[model samples]
Target: MTAIAVTIAGTDPTAGAGIQADLKTFSALGVYGATVMTALVAQNTTGVQGVHDVPAEFVRAQMRSVFTDLDVDAVKIGMLSRPETIRAVADGLAEFAARNIVLDPVMVAQSGDPLITPEAVATLRDTLLPMAMVITPNLPEAARLLDADPAGDEHAMLEQGRRLLDLGPEAVVIKGGHGTGAESVDLLVTQDEVVRLAAERIATRNTHGTGCTLSSAIAAGLATGAPLASAVRAAKDYLTAALAAADDLRIGHGQGPVHHFHALWPNLPGEKR
Candidate 1:
């Protein structure tokens, strides 16, 4: 059977960070992808100009439309700008008994623009954190979720991850991409162990959709029945390769996007550098 994954997120006009990025990552990783848009975002690599959140009832209806017919194997959740939308998604997950849920607590955009509300953040923490197989948060996002200072080192990262684990996620992956280092590190912390996954911190400004890509990549792996840890490792490798190739694409003026099809489109335009 073909593996299928769904992304319940928002729109990114640049196709780099929200629903579009999730779908791209799914396709690149060889999984069928479905999307339920929660917002219409007017944004580019520069910054978010505006947002129009989809109604909560419509969001619920969209989830039902996908869940009732499709054999969704995994779910990748992204931006839910409103508390009601977060609740709607949480309820739909339970309603459909969704499995292999990977949640990316996206509070801020790569451009340093805020993407979610404080009220919605609280709702996501209370309602969805416990239901996910894994929750991926960058350093700043982890800090926001825990209401503490962002982890400055590996030890702090693990500590915060453990705290988040206490909130009920089976595992917490605290991303060190936002930290300063020779190598970007991510910690996969579960009740049993802490696994350190590190990659060279590629120097580039094309990281617009990184969080969405990584989370969706995990969803793609899980959709094919990979274990949580294995899925995370694979996703990391994929992102690293994508980042390495990111500079080849000349997209926006500010932060561009990772090359989702780096391997598949070797000879494509703007990649001949």
Candidate 2:
């Protein structure tokens, strides 16, 4: 049976982040992709100029339509721009009882534009956190979610990951890509263990959609029946390779996107190693 993964996120016409990135990740990982746009972002690799959130009722309707018709195996959520949107999503997930929900707490964009409202942060923590199988937040987003100082060292990042785990997600992945270091270290904190995934930081500006891609890839892996740890491990591996093979071809003048299809192509698949 073909696995289906749904992404509840904003629409990025630039295709770097949000629903476009999630769908691309799902497709690359061989999972059928579905989406519910929570907001529409008018920006690209450069920066975000405007954001218009979708009506909460319409968001619910979209979820209903997808859950009613498809056998969704997993879900990836990102860019819920409003508290009402977050509540509506939580309601839909409860109504449908979707499994393997991966939440990417997206607060800021790669261009440093704020993607989420300050008030919506509480709603996300209280409403959506409990429903997530795993929540992926970058260092800055994690700080925002926890209301902690954003100037954290590696130790602080791990502490924040542990704190986020208490908010109800079965696991938390604190992405260290935003940290100031030569190596990017993502910490996965569960109730029982903490696993660290460290990789050499790729010095490329083409990392616009990394978080969205990672979360969606993890969702696809979960939908394919991989365990939580295994899914995260695979996701980290995939994103690392994707970053290393980033299309420095410069699609846009600003921060470009990762080479999502680097693993595909006639002979390039083996080159991923």
Candidate 3:
């Protein structure tokens, strides 16, 4: 059976982030991908120029449309930039009793562009955070959730990840790639245990969609019946490989995108769809 996963996110014309990246990651992981566009963003590797958010009613409608047809093994959410859209997502998921939901706290972009508004942040925390099976936030996003500076070290990252867990997510992953280090260490704080997933940070300018790709990869794993920790571990490995192969092809003049199809055509052991 093909695992079916849905991604609720804004659109990135460059396909380096948002729903575009989410769909590509899902397919690469051998999961069927569905999407609900919350917004349309005119963006590239360089920056975002415009954003048009979908209405709250429309977002809810899309959710209903998808849930009614697909069992939806997992759902990955990103780029809910408005208070209305955030609330609609929470309500829609609750209405469908959506399970194995992965939320990527996409507060900012690789180009340092603010994706969500101040009001939306509060809605995301108070309303949507509790709805996720896991919430993946980088150091900067974790800091924004606490209204402080980004974690400067691993200790700080873990500490903040624990704090975020209290907000009601089943687990919180504080991405350490943004921190200063030769290796990236992601802290996974859960009710049962704290798991540290460390990987050698690859050097490349082609890292435009790391956050979106990682979260979607996790969602795909969950959709395929992997445990939470196992899902995260698999996601980390996939992201590392994708990032490593990113520079092999030139997609944009600015920061290029990671290779989502790196494993798609290659017949890897259990990865053949």
lDDT of each: 0.95, 0.90, 0.92
- Model 3 C-alpha lDDT per residue in residues 1-273, reported as the tens digit of each score: 879999999999989989999999998888999999999999999988989989999999999999999889999999999999998999999999999999998988899999999999999999989989999999889999988888898888888988999999999989998877789899889988999999998999899999999999999999999999999999999999999878665787799899888765554454422
Off by over 4 Å in 1: 268-273
Q: For residues 58-99, write the lDDT of model 1, one tens digit per residue.
A: 999999999999999999999998999999999999999999
| Predicted candidate 2 versus true structure: per-residue lDDT over 1-273, tens digit per residue | 999999999888888788998988898899999999999999898989899999999999999999999999999999998999999999999999999999999888899999988899999999999999999999888888888887367788878888998899999999899887789899899999999899999988899999999999999999999999999999999999889978634567788888777778444343432
TM-scores of the candidates in the order shown:
0.98, 0.95, 0.96
TM-score of 1: 0.98
| Better candidate by TM-score, 1 or 3 | 1
The deviation in Å at residue 152 for candidate 2 is 3.1
lDDT of 2: 0.90
Q: Compute the lDDT for candidate 3.
A: 0.92
